[model samples]
Target: MAIDPKELRRCLGHFTTGVTVITCQGEDGTPHGATVNAFTAVSLEPPLVLVSLDRRSRLCGLLEARAFTVNVLESAQKDLALHFAGRPNQEVRWAADSACGAPRLDGTLAHISCTPWQAYDGGDHVLYVGEVQQFHIHEGRPLLFHSGQFHHLGGDHNPLLWDDSADGPDAGVSFISTLAGTRRV
Candidate 1:
């Protein structure tokens, strides 16, 4: 049976995600950005991240593989997100260079500077993987998207710590086991 696109979309909407603005210098030498939620860290060792963009998006055309920045939006920047997502709002407030010379927005949670590493075909979307060059992080809660609406994070944090020799959860250690037994520093 053929799957309906709307049904697929609704199913995928169950996953909560962080909002981001993928910014890059346009061919005209001006900064251009697109609001996207399809952004995630691809690797940690080489510092890689991936952003998926619609093939027909104007921002996709404006984007150059190398030299782009991912601005993780804060909850306060919902207007900015809507602006870049095709609803022009009031003037954007861009922050000056702190980590790299990429155009960044004020009130963002973090800025990730990247150079293109690879691109892959993703049907209607193109997955662009980038090597993180530099980054700046501000202390704040990130803007979140879920079920076609915005959400905020609840105050819950993991208090677990692992030793250097520990291999994380796959190392056969459970959270309850750690609390019940002596933990390695």
Candidate 2:
């Protein structure tokens, strides 16, 4: 069967993922980044992560040469995500990650410093697997992406399904159902 690119993209959109702005400083000493959702935790023993980037991205070469930082934005940071994802002509401001010299946004839920470990050619994109050298997690709900939009994670107003009915015996079932149907975003 012939695969339609548009259809493929739309189908992939169904899988919700957290949003992150992958940042790095170029050889020219300029900060560069792009909004990315293709991120995942690869290992926990030594701490590792994987982020895929389109080969044609301006930051690709810089990311290959130097260390990089992944700033996981909080729900309130939707503007930052949109900024980094903006056109190349737009301006962006970034600060340095002290441990690795990677660029990081001012405020984020978490910041991870990593050294490029492996780069594999993956069709139109390059898979960048990194070894995490250091990381910091702050208290805040994460910014999520689903169906091509940003979403806030938490609030007192949103009650847990199981907690909703104290007298209900189907709490466990309700919890599982909620988990299965709820997208991260």
Alpha carbon lDDT at 96, candidate 1:
76
lDDT by residue (1-185, candidate 2, tens digit) is 99998999888988878889999887888777888999999987778899999898876767895788888988887778887887444345555564878878777889898888888898999999888988889998889888877877656645434434433665454332253464221
| Residue 104 of model 2, lDDT score | 82
Model 2 regions more than 4 Å off: 87-93, 154-185
Report how far off residue 109 is in candidate 2 (Å): 0.5
TM-score of each: 0.84, 0.79
Candidate 1: C-alpha RMSD after superposition: 3.6
Output the worst ten-in-a-row residue range by lDDT, candidate 1: 173-182
Candidate 2 weakest ten by summed lDDT: 176-185
Clashes of 1: 0
Error of 2 at 14 (Å): 0.9
Compose the digit string of candidate 1's lDDT tens values, residues 1-185.
99999999999999999999988877766788999999988888899999999999987776646577899999788888999999998798877743545577777899898887988999999888888888889998888999999887767844455454545546665333254565533
lDDT of each: 0.82, 0.80
- Full-model lDDT, candidate 1: 0.82
